[model samples]
Target: MSKIDFLVIESDAARAESVVAALQFLGYHPQRGEECLVAEESTHAWRAVYVGGVADAAEAERQFALLGAAAAQVPLLAAADSPWAARLGAAGSPFAQRMATIAFPLRYEALAEAMRGLYARLLGSRRGELRFVGESAPMARVNALIRQVAPFDSSVLVLGESGTGKEMVARTIHECSPRRDKPFVAINCGAIPAELLESELFGHEKGAFTGAISARKGRFELAEGGTLFLDEIGDMSLPMQVKLLRVLQERVFERVGGTRSQRCDVRIIAATHRNLEQAIAEGRFREDLYYRLSVFPLELPALRERLDDLPVLIDEFNQRLARRGLSCVRFGASALQALAGYPWPGNVRELSNLVERLAILYPQGEVRAADLPEKYRGQPQPEETRGAALLAMMDARAPAAAVAPAPAPAHDATLLPEGGIDLKDHLADIEVGLIRQALDATGGVVAHAAKLLRMQRTTLVEKLRKYGMQGSLAA
Candidate 1:
């Protein structure tokens, strides 16, 4: 194991010595509070902060705060006897909520277990703009590859299924590289028409073609001294591939319909969902271009291939939603089990969409297997069986007197009248009434109203459209 840096903030000499000894035994480098404070200007990121034997809560808070931003990014581990441990474990403060408490005497076994969990969490947090939120073996390998290739300016070819975050990997490489201060320009080769792609990549001079009214800088010039991400490179036409190949080889490109060759100093990072090798065999892609682009190949695994990462990914997505002022949602055990069983054809993107939709539908609610969409609830037990099991479990936990008898059916459950009724219209009317109430309660905010009714915003919008109530409601 590598030597992880830990900041130890303890006032008692004996306790501080014991803490440092245990950290060294666990193969971690421990820096004293005074030492860390003196080296505050250093750009070192501590893996965790150890708080033990502080005089009181006030002194502990002051010393912890003094560690500054370096301490803020990492985990906090407090001893059981530490004066501030109780306050740090309280619910109000966000930082305190995440702090871990250890044994007072600092038993190695307990300390190791706490450290293990925190280390895994620390690994999943942000690394620059790279939010690689997974600790699975596949993701660990991907992160290792990124670290190895980021220092060099070699061409990287990222391969993954659609929605598997190929472009994210490309951006991570750029963000981790030495040229991160420069711009990162991206162009989707497949999205642009063949005629316009050349001008999009290599700028056209003023009046060079029909619509070339003004000269514009292309992606190569825009990404000078940084990275140019060519997405869906497999879709580039044969002629365009030839032109791109020339630029890759010579590091120079001539604008469309221009004689002057402009030198480019940009790193090339290309990605595609298609199999370039298959495209080459089919004679649809240039083999030479493929080789040039794949100097360092990085492949991202589909979400289904790494199910262990589901929980972390969901938490990261919820944090993102919360940062945007949207409500965060939590999934119950059964809901998570159902989600794990799902085959995510759309990969990470689909999961992200589901989280956002759930945030809109459930708000700060705990979602169960039944609450999930039908497609996601894989092979769930019948409602009758589930209800019986739930009742049995409740009976086992609660006293006989505490369990109330079932209530009688309500007035709304009365039999239909003799006159034939339009069941569809009746149901539609009930839905409209509920929607109107939810809308009114939320002051016409569709998203908030959707949460109140436990439905998606888009679903509510469609209902409003079908009822011809769009004009009356504020969207």
Candidate 2:
């Protein structure tokens, strides 16, 4: 195997910036240019070292001695920029003169070249860890899809309401893919103003407009050879979509101001909640761009549909809040039931805010049902819960009537220690009966009956599965 690349050390913040720019331009991701150089040197046998300056002359000398003893595995380059360098040079380090003659104030272009040549010896590997940590079925499905798709380079469109963790999914794809070592940059299309959105995506040359300061790399440039996440992409205007479409079809794009076409190999992963088909029909979104982005689409199911994950999400949030020292708070049993019952119109984002608020206000005790937000209190059965909206959508043409209702007695009516039957079984039976009744009412049109049952179609499927009759229902 080829050896690892060299380390680029710098004295101050500005020097670090210059060196980093040079290293990146030269295609080497430089290790920390700070005082941790010796620690890193010990851990990852670097091929070469660039010593800009030591942190403190006296203390640095002591640290340097530790490093000199540890650096037997690699070559060291001590750029002569400090008084300490002169001292080290005089200490009979054999390579001191060869390193010292390279001028201290190296030009940017020259520094970039040198760093490139130094890194050319090593074969690059993917940089860091890629992880996904949710056990929910919806999340598991997303992870599975990401694993399946990560080996290929293609534009991906993630469809979901906000706070559904679309960005996490996008990152998981990039991290597992061949471009894992490359940058995974993200930009919010809706956050920036419309006029500024274009320049932000493609970047602009200096003096392109009134506020132009210096030439800058946009998210695309920063994500070269990697992935770019265009969040809330539906919010981008028609004109910008056209330009983005051009880049997708052809791997070349022009900066906002400069006419020079820069060719880049970057995978694009876009996300949005808006119905782009409707937008395209309305002449707001471009059809070509829609097709390009939707080449691989993944829809994230809403939290309400995955209510079984509520407990998992709450526990995760509790641990996260505890790290911030809001440790004592926990959801009461009733509070949890209340959370599961609510419609969660805002989905996971709403749940997160409520959890944070509970942690802040009632940090040391069980949060009571009363502590729950007013909207969720005193819910009716799911059938009675969702209003009359479903009554208006049914008709006579739909077939597939509900199967014969299993009587309430066949339910898991276990005789309790002090009672004749388990109430849980009784209630589940009632829910099952209600679903069957709704299906019978609608003649089994899932959508129409889902409205009548006052539940999501997916929820009804799960409920049927719990009773071991879901297969018949699906058919």
lDDT string for model 2 (205-316, tens) is 9999999988876768867887889999999988788888888888888887899999988999999989989999999999889998988999988888788888877876
Residue 425 lDDT in model 2?
41
Q: Give the runs in model 2 whose Cα sits over 4 Å from its true position.
A: 1-133, 378-475
Across 1-475, the per-residue lDDT of candidate 1 in tens digits comes to 3333677889888888988998899987777775544433333335678888876657556656655665555678988887767776688865563467777665665576567545433443543434566889999999999988998999999999999888778777876788765666788999999999999998989889998888877879867898999999999999999999999999999888789989999999999999899999999999999999999999999999999999999998887665334678888665787899999999999999999998877764456565578899897433323233334333335776666554343333335757755566445544554665566656788887787677899988888777545543674
User: What is the number of backbone collisions in each predicted candidate, taken in the order shown?
Assistant: 0, 0
Residue 403 local lDDT, model 1: 62
User: What's the true lDDT of residue 387 in model 1?
Assistant: 34
